[model samples]
Target: MPLKIYNSLTRQKEKFIPINPPYVGMYVCGPTVSGESHLGHARPYITFDVVLRYLTYLGYKVRYVRNITDAGHFEEEGREAEDKISKKALLEKVEPMELVHKYTNLFHWAMKQFNTLDPNIEPTATGHIVEQINMIEKIIEAGFAYVVNGSVYFDVKKYAATHNYGELSGRVLDDLLETTRALEGQDEKRNKADFALWKSAPQQHIMRWKSPWGEGFPGWHIECSAMATKYLGARFDIHGGGMDLLFPHHESEIAQSFICNHVQPAKYWMHNNMITINGKKMGKSYNNVIKLTEMFSGIHPLLTQAFSPMTIRFFILQTHYRSTLDFSSEALVAAEKGLKRLWEGYENLKKIKEENFDLPDDNDLDKKINSLLDELDEFMNDDFNTAKVLANLFEIVPVINSIKDGIIEKNVLSSKTLHRMKDALTVYLENILGLQSLSQNNETFDGVMQLLVDIRKEAKSKKDFFTSDKIRNQLAELGIEMKDEKDGNISWNAV
Candidate 1:
């Protein structure tokens, strides 16, 4: 089946036909390095990481470009117009670049923990100043922008007259013009809808650069347009980010790129929905922004216990990317339990060796297994419905466990079918879904646990209740729960 992507621009799922066959270019808006990344930041990166992985699995060479906003990102654009990095640096009493390096490194560490693949090119906003300036000049020459008080602003009203300003975001220009909310630099703009291409730096601004519009930095929106054009060409396959950026940030990107390049920036636009904390929007004002560090360490007041990076990744995948995921201790705990169950089933499936050459004795069961395996790809192809894919994998897990526990006969499935099942499970779980074993020391830990299980089993067989009870009690004290299966086998997991 051909892959379908839900394009936010058109608000429909369309067949993904790359502009260049066998090669695809994707750009995702990455984190601003002014502060530590929070749970709100996890969704887009992980969602796009799976996209990158699945495309590669489908034999597409994808150049995934995710940018780092090391500079020019403002805190609530139009309200304050203060640079995020510069503001944070002043508070921390450090150089702007120093603060950027610290947070950027932390962001990379969090991504590594989540097992997200790095983008092919991670361009920084500050690093592409020349490209941004040239693009701004192009917009000016095209009469889509104007200069005021040494600052350049996009002529949104003019652009709207010639082109659909709200095509991507569905925002009407008339309403924006009527907005009475007082904003910084409102007097300088020809219309309230206009946004900055370059902001003239105040004397106290430490992160200023010399530009044709005097000494100042690039605007938040222009940074993305410049970097994406330079790396992914004037047009690319996909441009992805959180739904929050739909209005001004991404909408402005569309306007700027169209005016400068004379074409829309990307063929398809994708956005992951926002994350909420216990039904409330996650924000600093709400006192609910859980940083990735706080989440892993369980240092935040909202988190009941430390959550592993894989557990958080699994939690995010449980819901559709387009749906809002709510974070709570209860939801996270449930996700943790679910992940453990799925991992255990995966381990059991891997241990089953298909030595019998016999054909299926249970044709119905065999067909059911194959059907589930086939739907894995179909679900993924249908706009990357990872939630449905995971559901199907859970259904197959019982069949795998039944086979391992001797409830289902080995030769019931043909050798070909068994091999296919194994391959499909591995490909979907590890490769396409991008899940990894929870711990690196899992092998050694399992070996030790298995040895203990065997020792207890021998003691129980010899009718020595004392030694068996002692082993069981000690393991229970260590928070390891062991279940004695009906088939006289032992299964264990950490409680």
Candidate 2:
């Protein structure tokens, strides 16, 4: 079956047909770079990362673009016109660019920990000022924008008279006009619903640039439309971000693109749901946000233990992208244990080999195994239902473990079928899912562990009960388990 995607624009599932065959372009909104990335930021990056991987796996040359908002976007849009970066920098007593550099590096490090692929082009809002100016000029020339007192505002009421102003957001123009909140620049706007394309910079503003209107910066919404159009052309294949951006941010992008390019910006609009805690959305305002650094270091007051990066990724993938993933220490612990089990099963499957003895095929068992492997692709095609795909894999874990424990004969299935099952499990777990073993994999670490094990064995042989017990206790406290086998062999696993 052809891939099906749930388009937020049409509010339904539609067959994915790229405008240009075998070549797809995707644009996702990136971080604002004013602060460290938190748990909430992981969903879209991981979600779209899987999407990019799956498309490439299906033989498509994809160009993915994610932009960084390092300029002009204000805190509390339509109100103070204060740049988020500038405000944070002032409080931290540093240059705006210096702060951007610091947090952008942090964001990059966090994405790396999550194993997300880097975008083909990571355009910054500040880097494309000329492009933003050019696009705003086109909008003004097209009679959709008006300049007043050195600030340009999109004429929402005027544009609404001719086109569907709130089509992407499903907001009625009349309702928007009636409920428009008063902002700092409301006196200059003809209508309250009109959003700023360019805000006139006050003398104290530091991130000002020379635009057609005056020395000001591009508004929050215009930066994305300008950057995406510049890199992905007038129209692209898919536009993705968090569900929180479905309004004012993405809605304004649609309006700006229509005015400048005479068409919608992208064919498919996809959004991932938010991460919540205790049924409330996790944000800085609510004091519920767990920064990625805090999560990895277990420095936050709320975290029970430091979660491994792979465990966090697996936790997020356990829930559907469109569903809210509630956060808790218990849930994370469960995910950690579950992931260990899954990985153990995968490792066992990799070690299985075909036996030379030929026996009648167990058609029922073979069909069950084959069906589960084939359904992995089907579940992914259905709007990237990763949770379902994982569920199917979990069902195969016992079968693999059974084979490993000699509960099932290896010759019950053909060699080709066994090999195929191993390949399928590897592809979905490693390639498409982008998961890796979180345990240390270096030679130094391994050698140190072996040295410790050898010392403990020698201590036991010498009847030094105190030394051997001390070694075992210390290793257990450090999250390593040592097992004594019936043959006097010692094996270890990092808990």
Best prediction by TM-score: 1
For model 2, the superposed segments whose C-alpha errors exceed 4 Å read 77-79, 356-362, 450-472, 484-491
Model 1, CA-based lDDT = 0.89
Candidate 1 per-residue C-alpha lDDT over 304-383 given as tens digits, one digit per residue, 9 for 90 to 100: 99988988999999899999999898899999889888988998888889876667535888789888888988998999
Which candidate number maximizes lDDT?
1
Predicted structure 1, TM vs. truth:
0.95
Poorly placed runs, candidate 1 (over 4 Å): 76-81, 360-362, 442-454, 482-495
Number of residue pairs clashing in candidate 2, backbone atoms closer than 3 angstroms, sequence gap of 3 or more or interchain: 0
Clashing pairs in 1: none
Q: Estimate each model's TM-score.
A: 0.95, 0.94
